[model samples]
Target: MHQPLDIKDKSSDKNSIKVEAFRKHVRTTKPHKHNNYFELIFLSQGHGTHAIDQEKIDIQPPMVFGIGKEQIHYWDMDAEPEGYVMIFRSDFIMNSHDKALLELANELFSHSHILLSKDESITQFFSLLAKELKELTVSPYVVEGLLKALFGKILQMALHIKPTQDKSKNLYQQLVDLLIENKEYDRKVENYAELLNTTPQNLNAICRKIENLTASEVIAAHIVKEAKRLLAHSNSSISEIAFHLNFKDSSHFVKYFKRHAQVTPGAFRSSSLIEKRN
Candidate 1:
């Protein structure tokens, strides 16, 4: 069975940092990305294609990959793949701090919609942070003190990463920002290309080059993801989700879900709830 992408949709205040770390062995392969949290992966062991957007970058052990919310990236897991992941809300970091980090946070991982911070010093800091994080799972109240230190340490390390290449990413980022604002609208790729003052073929080519999927596919994925969220997190029925998504009817939405997700809306919700219980 395919698991939904690892998306942390939990809430946290600006003053508090909520974090969790775990090790998992890969039993299957899938494409997934976070929609609500920033992710830092300490790849302790494993090898896989870190497919960011549409571009597949080779990932090796002992490297940390940082992914931001709205960044569509995933790992096609291989055997014995284990890692430490620390995810916190972006509110945990401030804009002044963002100015401090500058390109480090932005370039950590990049494709079209996202860029990850990959500075050597920041990577090392997280290696140490991951060790400390493992301690919190056992010791408990250590969370508050350590969380502050971790954020500061990250800011410190951000100083070392160089500025990133902006020309390649700017256009795609605009498209994704537009996506965040207008998921309810059925905006075509041609529409985006025209808005960007480029040809449909050029926009499609760039999207595929950076994200491994077409612009249309990315929008459809968001629709499916939102549908799943409403299905699992709310009391809204299938018809409501379909209608809310502007589908003609429930049948249309059902077929749409099955084509990409390989599971009925009801079945997906039931399985997600079961996972929560376990």
Candidate 2:
């Protein structure tokens, strides 16, 4: 039988932010999930492929990989890797009270992999960020400022490399950001509309215009995607996963998952395990 998925809790009780140089090793890792934190991996050097969920991305140098809070990913490296890994939990961004920064972070994490140019400034930013975090006398404000600059520079580079359809912040973009930022597991359009301070009808219109899906459909897609990730990547029991997603109970979640995924949660998990084993 295949082993249970490895769920890593990298967050410490005290600090919500951390930075460190990437471990140098030539390896393949089992499919695993991280708990309650987003990781940004900046690799100035590396080779092989990174599997994020169902997509396999080639690892090229000078690239930034954003692993979302609940994504299932694994590394398959043919050569020794050299880089830095930056981790920050949701609370670090949410509690900052900077909506723009929070949205920017949400956008950054939305993309699984972003190719970057070989700019010395990017390396310098990471170097300075690591130094600030390592210094015992460094103030929290200094660390936060450095982080802001680093993320801003990365985002700018990502946009320059590949621009999205609409660069302006619209209602649809705000809704997308709110869905990711708010971890309430609320799949209701009315609740999201309330949070967005708009009517459900208006929200639905915007979603249809942007994604060709209704507002309720969009919310359900987000919840179902997260549910699938947990089922496939975490060792959490069905009941535990249900509670984590704020479902009324396991039965309700099972029905929801079956309806959307067209497979029972247990069967899905079993299949995921089988695939990994092969």
Candidate 3:
């Protein structure tokens, strides 16, 4: 029997947040998904590729990668990597009840990769954060403050690297969050709009404004993305996948996948297998 992608736990049971030197833990990893945490990696030095879902990024110094909980990623480092890795869960933010901070994190986590310019402030921030995390008497308030500042610095640099629209009171982010949270493959724009407390037209307007796609398109895109993940990472057959995704039948799923991805599910799976082999 074919095995599924590995699911790894990189959490700190003692605290909601954990920070460590990346070099100490740096190694090539098989494709895996983390268990319910946000991972932020800052590399001062590294060489190789980091594949997050479908996108493979070149490892360049002074860069950061924010891996979300649902993303599948792997490292193929050709050299020793020097960096810091910070792991935190949503519980850390939710416990604070800081809506602004939660929104900031949501925006930052939306991007999987960010190339950074040389910034002494970022290095200093990470160093200070690591030091604080090591203290026997760790201060939650101080850690929270440091995290905010560090995230701000990284986001500031991210703006210059890739300009994103202001997501203040971001309905699009909310919609995406709901989509990711959902498990039953309910990809209806009307259902999501209702849950978001807005009309489908308004949701579409917001989605189009932020993502240049209709709400329906955004939902379809998410469905396709999940489909691709299941195809590549799971050992389920097309019929099983269709059932799991709540499609009426396997034939319907095949047509839908083809309409969006321009290839049949079987073809996609075959290509994924071939890619894995070589």
Candidate 4:
């Protein structure tokens, strides 16, 4: 069994040194986090809901799934799906000159970039990608070249993506950066709008235009995302978790969690812990 991606610090020295791949079951998924490794899945088998970030999609055969370290995701298994999951340390491509591509690769897998495309060319590219992964297991030089190609493919797809527009996106991204950096979940939109030198309405309009997300949507995203993190890791009480998240009350936090996640906070926490122990 494997720990949830959240509990293990993928950025730790332990995850920094190796590239590994194998088949794994859903039981190993406990809402864990990945901090160091960039992961890709050639889910040749399996059928179920694959929850990544806020996107929940069904897993069909031959899907190319990407997960990054910061994304808290889970597989609620159904139909006994089995697949190949490959994890490689980020340092494996640390010295590459193609900063944009490498960063896109990391971001795509790390969950920062959660959008996926239904483009036809992606299928052909992934065919080559799967073949390269096979070669990497037997040849280091081949693996290195594959890594570079993988990075390039990531950028190519990203460039072709239709931007997710939101109305107050400038404020949203800024506030998201602010909250992520400061570790505050309850910050107001006005706070961000004020800092951006715009009215809340103006900021909200931009985020909605850019991402189809409202100012509140952006805020709730940050809060719920972090709540998922705490639920997966620390064995803190619901009340304590509320306090840590700066919620006005435990009930408010619980309601917020359920609204965004479709589960009570306690349920999510307990489910993650049980999955890890199983």
Best model number under TM-score: 3
TM-score versus the correct structure, for each prediction: 0.49, 0.76, 0.90, 0.54
> Candidate 1 regions off by >4 Å?
1-106, 109-166
lDDT of 4 by residue, 1-278 (tens): 22233445534453333333334544336555565565676555566777775566676564557765466676676666544455666555555565444444544443333233333554444455457654535554555556556545544555335332233333444454456555556558887778778898987887677568888887787788778777776667778878878888999888888988799988887887786687
Could you report the Cα RMSD, in angstroms, for every candidate shown? 9.8, 4.2, 2.2, 7.3
The deviation in Å at residue 26 for candidate 1 is: 29
CA error at residue 71 for candidate 4, angstroms: 3.5
Clashes of each: 8, 0, 0, 37
**Global lDDT of each candidate:** 0.59, 0.79, 0.82, 0.60
lDDT of 1: 0.59
TM-score for candidate 3, residues paired by index: 0.90
lDDT of 1 at 212: 81
Worst lDDT run of 10 residues, candidate 3, spans: 160-169
Stretches > 4 Å off in candidate 3: 12-14, 159-169
Over 79-109, each residue of candidate 2 has an lDDT whose tens digit, in order, gives 8888888888877876775555655675676
lDDT-based ranking: 3, 2, 4, 1
Per-residue accuracy of model 3 over 21-58 as CA lDDT, tens digit each:
88645669888888578799999888999998878899
Candidate 1 lDDT by residue in tens digits, 92-152? 4433233323234444534222223444543455566556555535433344345444444
